[model samples]
Target: MSDHDPRPDASALPWSCEAEQSVLGALLVDNAAYDRAADLLRRQDFFDTRHGDIWDAISRLVLAMKPADVVTVFDALPEAKREEIGGLAYLGQLAACVPSAANLRRYAEIVRERAMQRALMQTADEALEVARGEGSFEEKSDRIGSLFATVRETGQRSKPLFVGDLMAQRVDHYNALAQGTVTPGISTGIPGLDEALGGGMWPGKVIVLAARPGVGKTSLAQQILLHGAEAGHTGLLLSQEMERTELVDRAVANLGSIGYSRLLNGKLSNPEWQRLGPAVDRLAALPFAIDDQAALTLHDIRTKAFAIKGLRLLAIDYVQLCAAPKGAPRNHTRNDVLTEISRGIKALAKDLGLTVLLLSQLNRDVEKRSSPEPTLADLRESGAIEQDADVIAFLWRVREYESHRLIACSLPKNRQAKPGAKLGLDFEGHYQRWRDSAEKVGHTGSVGGSADLGFN
Candidate 1:
C-alpha cells in the first residue's frame, strides 16, 4: 500500500510489515503451509493492504487446486492491483527472501496479534469520543460495551467440519456425566424440586419465580442463592426492595432455622441462640454477596456482575422494582419501562452465561382469582419476562389446614422439562424457609395467614 494511506502511522499503531511479508513468502515457497495460515490469519490481519491482496490472490489459487507459485499468483492479480503493489518483480523478491516455510505459523501469529492491538486501540478511541458527548454513566458504559463487543465478535470463515471429531467430543461429555465429573446443572439441594427442574437451575437460563406480595418469594429466591453458594458456586443477590440486613437475616434464618422475628428484633429463644453461631460462621464462609442499593439501574447490576471474579448465579429480588435507566422516553408507561428492563436483563443473562433466578411480583388479579393459583399471565408489569424466561414457576400460599398454609410451587412453564406439575412445600415462617411437604390437596383446616413479607 502507498505510504500516504489514511491509516495511522506504522510506529504509532501495532503492525508488522516484515511479518506480513514473511507470511506471504512462506505460502509461495510451500503451498502446504497455506492450510495452517488460512486457519489463523484473515486478510484484515495484514498491516499493508498490498500484502493482504497478495495473500487473498494466493488463497484463491490454492483453494481452486491450482499451484500458487510467484508466476501464477502474479498473473492472478488485475493490472491496476499489479501496478499498485510494485508489480510481479516485488512478488519474486518476497519469494526469494524466505528460506523455508518453517516459520509460517509464527509469522501468522504476529500478524493476528498486531491486528488485535489495532482493533482494541480503535475501540478505545471510539469510546472516548462517545464519552465526550453528553450521556449518563449507564449510557456511556453500554456504548463502551457495544464497541468492545464488535471487536470481540470474530468473523466466520469456511472450514472443514468432521462428524468423527464431534462424536469424540460427545463421547467424552457422556463419560463425564456418567462419572459425575460434572453435575447436570447448578443443583437446588431440594430433591423433588430439583427433579421437577430436570436437575437444577441451568446455565444460560432465566428462571422466573413469581408470587403475590405476602408469599415469601424473596425468601425462596434467597434460599436458592445460598444453596448455590453452599455448593462452591459464586452468587450475587441484587435486591431493589429488601435492605442488605433483611437479606442476610433471611439467609441466617434459613441456615440456622431460627425465627426470622428473633433475628430481626434481637430476641432469640435459647435453643435458637445455640444454633445461631455455627450458622453465622457457615454463612460467612460461603461465596455469596448482596447488593441492596435503593435505585439500582440495569446498568448498575450488570457492572456489579462483571466485577465479581467468578460469578455463576445472580438473583434479582423482584423485577418490577429496578429503576428505569436514564434517557428513557418521556412518554413511556410503567409497562413500557418494565418491558425494556426485562428485555435488557435477559440479554445480560445470556451475554454473561449467568444462571439467573429472577423474582417477579404477580398481578393484583392473582389475589382476586377464586382458585388462588398463579399463572404466567399473573406476571406483573411486564409480559416480557414470561416470554424471555426459560422457566416460569409460580408460588402461592394455599390454605389446606388451619394450623399452617402450604406454599405451592408450580412449574407451569419450563422449557427444558415437562411443566404443569406442583410441589407442596411447608413454609416454616418461624425460620422464614420452605421444606418439601407431601401434604394431600384435600386436607382441611381453618386456613389463615397474613400476606406479610415481614415474616421473611
Candidate 2:
C-alpha cells in the first residue's frame, strides 16, 4: 500500500491531474524551471500521490543545486515506490508530456486551487457532521463556522492530527528550546516583558496595548517595533496617527540617545551629530517598513502586508483609527463599529500568522474612577477588544509623568502566561526612548549617553 491514500470522494472532488502532471513534467524537462515554482506548490498540492513523490525528489535535487531530470528522479525513488508509479518509463512520459516550461506557474496555480477546493469540500464535510450531531442551532452553527475558519486560519489540517504525534512534536520543541536550538517567539527586547509574555509575543496572537492620549502609547509601541526590527525580524508599522518623518525621528532619538526636541528643532550639538551616524546606519539595516497613510481599512492593511515578504510583526497605532473592510452600517453604534474592526484585526492576525501589536485608547471612564489606571474595561469603544485579544496590557502611571518618567506596563489578561504581570520601563521623552527601569540616562563630556540597549 502507498503512504498517502486517496480520500473517499477523491474522484468527486475538484482536481486537475493534468495540471499536476504538467508541473512535474516542466521541472523534469527543464531543470532550471524549478525557479518558476518558487516554493509555491508543496507536495501536498499535487492530486496524484506519485506526482507528489516526484515533486519531492525534484525539490530536493534542485535545492541541492543539482539537476532534477528523468535518470536522477528514478534513482532517487525507492525500488518499491518506483514500481508503484509504473517504473522509469512513467517518468519519461511525464518529461515529454509538456511542450514548454513557460506555463509552469499557471499549472502550479491550478494544482493549488484544486487542492484548496478539495480542502474546502473536506471542511464542508466536517461541518455536515457537526450539523447532524446533537446540539442547539447556535452551537452547531458556531461549530460549523469554526470549521471554515480553520481553513482560513491555517489552510487545511489535511489529516486528523493525533495528539500522540503532536505531543512528540511538542517534546522536540521543548527540547530545542532548552538546548538553544530554537526560540519561542521574537523577543520584545525587554527581558522582564519577555518573561511575562512567556518568551515573547508569539505568532498568531493579538496583543492589545491601550492608553489614554498624551500617555506615550505611540512612543512605547514604536519602541517595541524598533526592537523587533533590530533583532532581524521583518516588521511593518501602520501609523494612522503619526507622520512617517516623526516616526523616523523617534526611532533616531531612541536609538542614538539624542534629545528629541534638539533633533527635531535642528539644534543637535556636535556630539549628538556624531551619534546620529550609527543610529542612521542601524535604522538603514533594519528590515522594517512603515505605512502612514491615513484611514487604512483592514483590506488595505492585508493587501499591503502581502507585499512585504517574511512579515512577522504588524503594529497599528490605535485600533480606533482603523476602518473596517466593508465599512460599518449607519445604525451601528461606536462600540459596534469598533467591535467589527477588532474582530477583523484578530482574524487577520491569525490568518497571516502574525504577532499584531494592536494599540488602542483607554476610555475616559478610567480617569473618572478613583484610580487613573486602566483595566480590560477601558479598551476604548469595543468590548470585542477584550474578547479578540490574546494579551491586554495598559500603560499605567499614577504619579507625575514628565518628572519621574516611569511608565508601568500592566498586563491584566495574558493567555500564554500568568496575568496581572507588571513591568516598569523608564521613559526618556527627551530621547523618545524607553529603557529598563534599572537603566539610567546621563550626559557625559559633551554627548548624551544611556545604558547599553544591546541593539546593533
Candidate 3:
C-alpha cells in the first residue's frame, strides 16, 4: 500500500499492435496510417511467398476493392475478424474523402454497374447448377438478359479503332525495324513458304497447321522454331507431348543433317558428333525457349508467352491436349472449350501483336473418307477454330509411314490470299525437315533447297 495510488494510469506501457497483424495495427494508431503502411509495404516489394500473400491481400483491401469475383481471396476471415480490421475502416474513411458525386444519375450508374456484375455471377451460378437442364422461360430470359448486359459492357470497354493510333503504331514498327529491333516472324528458309506467309508470320494472326497423328506437324513446327531463333527473333515452343531434351534432339537432328532417331538412341558416331556439335551450339545460342509441360492449359501457355520480351511468335503444339480454364460452365462441351481456347489464342495474337502458330488434330472423318485430305471441317473440336484463325493450313502426308517423304499443305482459309491453294512439299525424315520437292509445280513463290539452308 506504500506505493499504491487510488488513481492509476495504464499509459506507461507501450501500446502493442494487434496480435498476428501488421496492416490493421498501423491503422489502429492513426486511422489514416493504413495507406502509408500499404504504400511502404508495396515499395519494399516483399519477395517472400508468405509475406507476398499477406501483402497482396492487404494491398487489395487498402484500395477498397470488392473481393467478389475471386472467392478464395478473403475466405479465411470471418465477419467479426473483418470488422476488427482497422485497415478496412481506414479505407472506408479515405473513400469518403473523395468528392462525393452530387449527381444522383452518376451514382445510380455506378450502382447499376455493380449490380450487373452480381447479376452476371448469379447467372453463371445458375447455369452451372442446372447442368443444361431446362428452366422456366422467365428464368431463362432473365439469365439471357444478364449475359447480354455483361457482354455489352465488356465490348463497350474494349479498345476502339482509331486511324491516328494506327498510323503511329506503323511508324513505331518501321522505326523498330530500322534500328534492328524487329525479329523475323517465319524465316523457315523455305522461300516459297516464307513468301506465302507474307514476309514470315504476320503479327495479329493465328495460323493453324493441322494434321493427323504420326504426321510431320511437330517436325515442321520445330523447324520453324529454330529458323526463327537463328533469324534474331524470340520464339517460344510449348510442346505438351514431348520432353525438352527430345525437342532439342529434333532441332539438332534437323539442323545438323542427321537422323532424329539416331540422335535419340545415341547412335551418332564421332564423325556425326563433329558435324552435330556446331549445329547444336548454334541452336543452343539462339533466342529459343521450350516448355515441355504436359497437360498445359490456355492460361498456362499465356503466362509463359507473356514472359518473352519482344516476342515474335508463340507456337502451341496440338490444341486438343491443352485444357481450358477451370470453373467454366459445366454444360460447356469440349466444343465450347475449344472455341474458348481458340478465341483466347487469337486474342493473344492481337494483344501481343505477334504471330501464333496453333497445331491442331484432324477428326477421324479425314481417315474414314476416301478423299485422303483434311478440310476445314476436319479441324478437331470447334468450328470456331477455323473462324478465329486468320490462316488455316491443312497438312497431309499421302504416305505417312512410307519411307519416301511427301507432305502436302493446303491453305483452306487465308483471309488475305486465295483460298484452297496447295503448297506441296517433300519431307526428309532423317533430318526431320520439310522442303520444296523437285516435283513442286505451279507454286509461284520463292524457292530454296535444304542444302542452301545450311542443313546440308
Q: What is the model-wide C-alpha lDDT for candidate 2?
A: 0.78
Worst 10 residues of 2 by lDDT: 439-448
Candidate 3 per-residue C-alpha lDDT over 7-96 given as tens digits, one digit per residue, 9 for 90 to 100: 232133221112112332233223344433332233122222232344455445546644311232334334444433332443343234
Q: Where does the lowest 10-residue lDDT sum fall in candidate 1?
A: 440-449
Whole-model lDDT per candidate: 0.81, 0.78, 0.63
**Which ten residues in a row are the worst by lDDT in model 3?**
1-10
lDDT of 3 at 57: 56
**Candidate 3 collision pairs:** none
Per-residue lDDT, model 2, residue 369, is 70
Expressed as tens digits, the lDDT of each residue in 243-306 for candidate 1 is 8987888889889988887788889999999999999999999999999886667667777888
- What's model 1's lDDT at 370? 65
Query: What is the per-residue lDDT of model 2 for residues 1-456, given as tens digits with 9 covering 90 to 100?
Result: 223444565668798878888998898888888866755688888778888888988999999998888999988887888877767888888888999899998998798888887888889888999899987875676566556766664553244556987998899899999999888888888787888888988999999888877668888778888899888778999999989998899899989988887887889999999999999999989988998987766556666776789898999988888764332456877777778778877877776798999988887887677655577877767788899999998885533344336666788899979998877777677887766786321211111133322211
Model 3 compared with the native: what TM-score? 0.60
Cα error of candidate 3 at position 202, Å: 0.5
TM-score of each: 0.82, 0.65, 0.60
